[model samples]
Target: MQLQKKSKKISAIAQNKNLSIQFSLDGFSFCITDLTTNDVNLFSEYIFEKTIASPELLLEKIMYIFANDKDLQQDFKSVSAIHQNNLATIVPNDFFDRNNLVPYLKYSVKTLATDFITYDNLSSINANTVYIPYVNINNYLFQNFGEFEYMHHASVLIDKLITKIKNSSIKTGFFVNVAPNLMDIIIIENDKLSMYNSFSYSCKEDFIYYILFTAEQLQMNPEEFQLTFLGKIESDSDLYKITYNYIRNINFIESTTCFFNEDDDFSNHSNYILLS
Candidate 1:
């Protein structure tokens, strides 16, 4: 399958030895870092819409990266993938049964594929439950990359946001993570997760509509509840302008810099916190 290239710029640090990959419906992104020096050696991202119909495209891209970079091929120490597909559901811990996870998913999603899986977030013990959904391309990764850890992107973000909230005095707020054509909305109250879900939007209006609607449904006041933005968002972008116009208390969540060397370019990358 022929894949259209969206943006293909590699960072100066692209020669790093360690690698981390993130897969989304719009595309796949990988970061090369030197764990020894804690510096991000390189970062590359690609966009391919035909990935769903031809999952092999994913393998092709991975191979291309390995083939071109000899440093990445020989010095690679670890590889981890974050599945960004939206077909996931969160269930509470008390009533969660592994055996019934698939059935529970089927009732909510119309999936034709049989390879459903789950990820448990140990950090959120109070809201214990399994996150269920299928990551189609993981099979290809296992066959090619050997053993590696796979996680629902939402699970990672939720865990990170919850940890941040727990350390802060803020008792109630909403966390919004914007991905390519997708968004993850998480609600926290009193240091516990009240709601966690994903939504797809084509425009800024749709995006704001979902936020306002969710806040209204939960009886949250837009002026009172703090809303933190993360992922692919810019302060000058229309999405930010619209959100600011409607929501009184909103700000960009600071990106965690431990995973990569601090650089002006690195700070511009979206979702670095969750992707790392």
Candidate 2:
């Protein structure tokens, strides 16, 4: 892998000591704040120089965060891990069987001995089964943090997007969330989740291809339905340019949830997944 930019970090003073941690294969991010007042004390985003494919490497990064930020080592009011691996699937809530999660993911992802089966129930649609391939890292989290919640990245975004659609008048819309090397495409119609899936892309063309093809397969007119973008994308980016050229009604989503501080540098669309 070619060398990329280093991580980004930001912090603020806090009135109380509450912490939330979220991380993925591409980055680790956390926010420390007072839940009562919603005052964020510290927020940081660390973009890994290379893709983390092993549990050992993931542990090293987690250890590095704890070593550098002594505050994270202390007890917090809450702690949560938003696993962001692309190996996820959404099954209808009524038909979901926890015991059969592995078979569903096996067809899409390679079986790994360390992969743990976890699921997050959507607000009104389906359950997302995520194959989190970080067994040793999860063990370390359990040993250190006693009891913490685990959520898939897609689940968080889906939850937020569902809320947005319900509150808005738009009857149909597609949300395309872009990450470093991943793209999560979600389709919503009649105020319900129609489809949700993630795809890997190596270039701008590949990224736009998936979006256009998915819309075509769904028989959704790109020019008719509104397409909202989230996650790591910028209006000036090639990914955005290519997508805009192919789709007419494309716009970036604004952050409405009070997850980040007003002073935080996290972008509305770029950091949506991490900050959600």
Off by over 4 Å in 1: 1-17, 36-39, 48-72, 126-136, 258-269, 274-276
Q: Name the 10 consecutive residues with the lowest summed lDDT in model 2.
A: 1-10
State the lDDT of candidate 1 residue by residue for 1-276, as single tens digits. 445432223445433455677776567777666676766655666656543444455556656654664444544566677777667777776767766667656765556655555756545744433444334466666665677777777777777777878888888869888876788789988878888878878889999999999999999999888898887787888998999999999887765554334553334437554344
For model 1, the local distance difference test gives 0.68
Q: Model 1, residue 15: displacement in angstroms? A: 12
* lDDT of model 1, residue 78: 67
What TM-score does each of the candidates earn?
Answer: 0.81, 0.88
Best by lDDT: 2
Clashing pairs in 1: 13-41, 13-42, 14-41, 14-42, 93-128
lDDT by residue for model 2 over 133-216, one digit each (tens)? 466666778888888777787788888788888898888879998888889999988778888888988888899999999999
Cα lDDT listed for each candidate: 0.68, 0.75
